[model samples]
Target: ILEEHAFVDELAEREIPVVPASRIDGRTLHSFAGYRFSVFPRRGGRAPELGDSATLEWIGRFIGRIHAVGALTPFQHRPALNPQTFGRDPFDYLRNHGFLPPELAATWASVVEQALEGVARCYERAGELPLLRLHGDCHGGNVLWTPDGPHFVDFDDSRMGPAVQDLWMLLSGERQEMVGQMADVLAGYEDFCDFHPRQLYLVEALRTLRLIHYSAWLAMRWDDPAFPAAFPWFNTQRYWQDRILELREQVALMDEPPLWPV
Candidate 1:
């Protein structure tokens, strides 16, 4: 927690727009009972309109700056976003726990194997790409936009990964549309840091890992009362079926050409 807070503090010092953790008596984390927690000041803003090319570019610049600073030095304690942590471990958890419906269990297992294989191919295609500290979860919800501009929040998922790991989540819609959006983002991003076109291969691969990880995450938190109420549909046959289909789609997507900036 302290390391994450320090990263945020460094970014703030560099003039990057980010909401760093609030200190309590000069401490970033507090121990209460058996739990440790960090506090962040409440910031008011709304999700940026990512559909706008300008907004895409604007956010891209900030993200690029974050990456540029992140590349300066590696995190001594943070983990890397990798197949073992994000892919294999989660899949193994679900398998060992027998979380899948009986009827879909075999099918789910088969497809997940294929999906992981696809992810392997993506890494192979990417070859040796650079790794840096990243937001890890740079989706729309983590970014807040106001009259001034966008400010990043939530570094809880921050880790070491390819720069594209922070950029891919911002893209949506059809391939052609995403290509255009990628172009806009890269235009501004290049102002601060260089982007490797090869990292694009991991877009779908990373997405597949997230899908696998999400199911395990929900399962791990099932005992939490809030999880059951919020995710009533989880652990259902239909949910596993849908996930199977999603992974199947990802397998095909990983085989497709990586998205290039237009």
Candidate 2:
């Protein structure tokens, strides 16, 4: 709630075309609505459209500015429950839950372990760089558009986490050579927070772990009639369950399991 308000104030203060300000209503849960609900600018406009140089450039600039604000602000809205802190990393979430199929368990486990290792190494690397607050969740759904260009919304998940957490979702998708695109996005974000390789891996693992937790929750709540079926978890795709788990394996295989390492 505070993050949303801060975003509204920050964007408006910067003259960015963000959604209108929202005010808390009398109802519980602090319900509020914005004066400007989006039409989503263009029907199929999304990061995947970054294939176009112009679109990619626009995305780059917008993200750059957004990240700049993150550096300027110290306050952040924290989540009620953080999976990275509580849940067994992304791979474990899939394994313990019924999210993954038995056949792919080993492969998924291997991959995610590797990614986790990479995440740790990334933290080590980031030790040399400065840290700051970030969007926490920078994805297509939170980013809407207007006549001017792309506008970000939904700052509920805002936090003082790795900037890569923001970059991962913005750059994670079926787009070709997404890693390259991710690198490009990092370059753009660097104009603000100063990207480090470790921060990149940390954010990737955090984002992937976030998804794993989200998927499990979605699977549990999917049966509710009011719940929409469009969520990735609702679709029962193996990759959704295995994606982060596979990455973690790469992290695990890199070094012997560290029982107690700084």
Candidate 3:
């Protein structure tokens, strides 16, 4: 937590638009009853309008500035975004814990294995891509737009990874739509930092990893009361069946050409 706060603080100091957690008495984290917590000031803003080309470009510039600063130093304490932590570890956890339904277990395992294999091929194609500190979770939900522009929140998932790890989630829709969005984002992004074309290959790979990791995450948290209430559909046979189909689709997408910027 301290590491994440410190990183956000660094960005804030550089005039990057980010909402860092507030500190109390020179400390960002406090312990009470053996539980540790950090407090962030209450912030309010609506989600960024990503459908707007201008909004997409603005976010691209923001992330580009973040990467420029993030590239300056390595994070000694944070983990790297990789297949092992994001894919393999979670998959192993679910498999070992017997979380999958008995009827779907074999099928789920087979599909996930195939998905991971596709991810491996992506890495092979993106050989020797650059790794830098990243927001790690830079989807639209993390950004808030006020009248001024967007301010990014939540550095809890911050880690060392490819820059595209911070960019891919902003994209959606058909191939052409995503390509157009990518072009807009890069138009602003390149103003601050150069992008590696090779990293494009990992887009679908990272997506596949997130899919595998998400199921495992839900299973691991099933013991928590809030989790079951919030995710009632999780761990259901239908859920695993849907995930299997999702991974199968991702496998095919991974085989397609990487998105090219306009």
Could you say which candidate leads in lDDT? Answer: 1
242, model 3: CA deviation in Å? 0.8
Q: Candidates' TM-scores?
A: 0.97, 0.62, 0.97
TM-score of 2: 0.62
| Model 2: residues with Cα > 4 Å off, grouped in runs | 24-48, 80-83, 86-118, 172-193, 203-207, 219-224, 228-262
Write the number of the candidate with greater lDDT, choosing between 2 and 3.
3
User: What does candidate 3's lDDT look like per residue over 1-262, in tens digits?
Assistant: 7778888999999999898877799898899999999888888899988878999999999999999988999899888989999999999999999998888889988988888999999999989877888998999999999999999998888999999999999999999899899889999999999999999999999999989888887888889999999998888888888998999999999999999731
Could you give me the TM-score of model 1 versus the true structure? 0.97
Which residue segments of model 1 deviate by more than 4 Å? Answer: none
lDDT of 1 by residue, 1-262 (tens): 6778888999999999998888778888888999998888899899999999999999999999999999998898987898878999999999998789889999999999999999999999898988998999999999999999999998988998889889989999999999999888998899999998989989999999999989999999988999999999999988998999999999999899988631
Q: Each candidate: RMSD to true structure?
A: 1.3, 6.8, 1.2
lDDT of 2 at 61: 67
Enumerate clash totals for all models, in the order shown: 0, 24, 0
Candidate 1 clashing pairs, residues 3+ apart or interchain: none
Question: RMSD in Å for candidate 1, one decimal?
Answer: 1.3
lDDT of 2 by residue, 1-262 (tens): 5554565568667875455454345211342374433221223334345544455556666666766775775664454323354235534545766756676666656665555556556556447544455555667777665455777665656666555566666554443456567656655555644555554435444544664566555656766766664654454555545564554543453343321122
Which portions of model 3 show Cα errors greater than 4 Å? none
Clashing pairs in 3: none
